[model samples]
Target: QQQVRQSPQSLTVWEGGTTVLTCSYEDSTFNYFPWYQQFPGEGPALLISILSVSDKKEDGRFTTFFNKREKKLSLHIIDSQPGDSATYFCAASAGSNNRIFFGDGTQLVVKP
Candidate 1:
């Protein structure tokens, strides 16, 4: 996808609650989608993402949902903790170049 857009500039979730972040892409040619997390004063890191062949992929308390028909994807975090507060970026990549296009990022705040 050439352009990825994420919703809700920022959000706040309570500890042990669930947090959701959404993203939409313009192009369907893109194959790989990834979600990244970044904390203040630190570089973005891979939180939980895969090659994403299936509609849903999950790891621990994190889950990603992809809707091929809607051209949208979302990240769901269950049992959210204060430490989980950070900025998340949704991205897509395609072709042999492996160039990834990222969304503007959503700031998540997990309250204690």
Candidate 2:
């Protein structure tokens, strides 16, 4: 069975502090990993992604560290601002199928 799992159901941090979210998958066939960020009223938007071929991926203030051998990955938020307070989901999918398995997000709160 294919599955994605995320840790820390919720997180609280002060503005400018960093937070880390973790995820793991059960399927070795999965190749694409994408992390999505979502605000209160809006839909989740793609934040960063990493391919199984690479071990790490970074975009601006967000970074995704992947361990293909262990089927685990982590998303790090650096210099987190209040605007960064949102739910983050770790999703995975195989290239053959359009289906993506999304883990329950970790809700983040950045206090000013």
Candidate 3:
């Protein structure tokens, strides 16, 4: 069974602070992991960043960590801003099936 789980259902970060969220998957076959950000008012899902198995990626104020053996993934936001407040989802996918398993999502609130 493929499943993805995110920790800290909700998070509060001050402006200029750092935001951290963790995710774990039960399926080792999952090789592609992507973190998405969603805002209110029926906004479209925004792709924050992506990570590959056994690799770490960072771009601007965002960073991602992936552990293939541990089946874990994480996202960190440097200098959190009020505009960054939104629901973030961690998703994973494997080969062929094209099935994506997404975490419930982590609700983030950045206070100015």
Which parts of model 1 have CA positions greater than 4 angstroms off? Answer: none
TM-score of 2: 0.95
lDDT by candidate, in order shown: 0.89, 0.93, 0.85
Best by lDDT: 2
Any runs in candidate 2 off by more than 4 Å, and if so which? none
lDDT of 1 by residue, 1-112 (tens): 3499998889999999999999988887877889999999999998876564779999999999988889899999999999999999998877567688899999999989
- Cα lDDT tens digits, model 2, 10-95, are 99999889899999998889999999999999999999999999999888888999998889999988998999989999999998
Q: Clashing residue pairs in candidate 1, if any? A: none
Show the colliding residue pairs in model 3: none
Q: What is the lDDT of residue 64 in candidate 2?
A: 96
Ranking by lDDT: 2, 1, 3
lDDT of 3 by residue, 64-85 (tens): 9887778888999999999989
The local lDDT score (0 to 100) that residue 6 gets in candidate 2 is 95
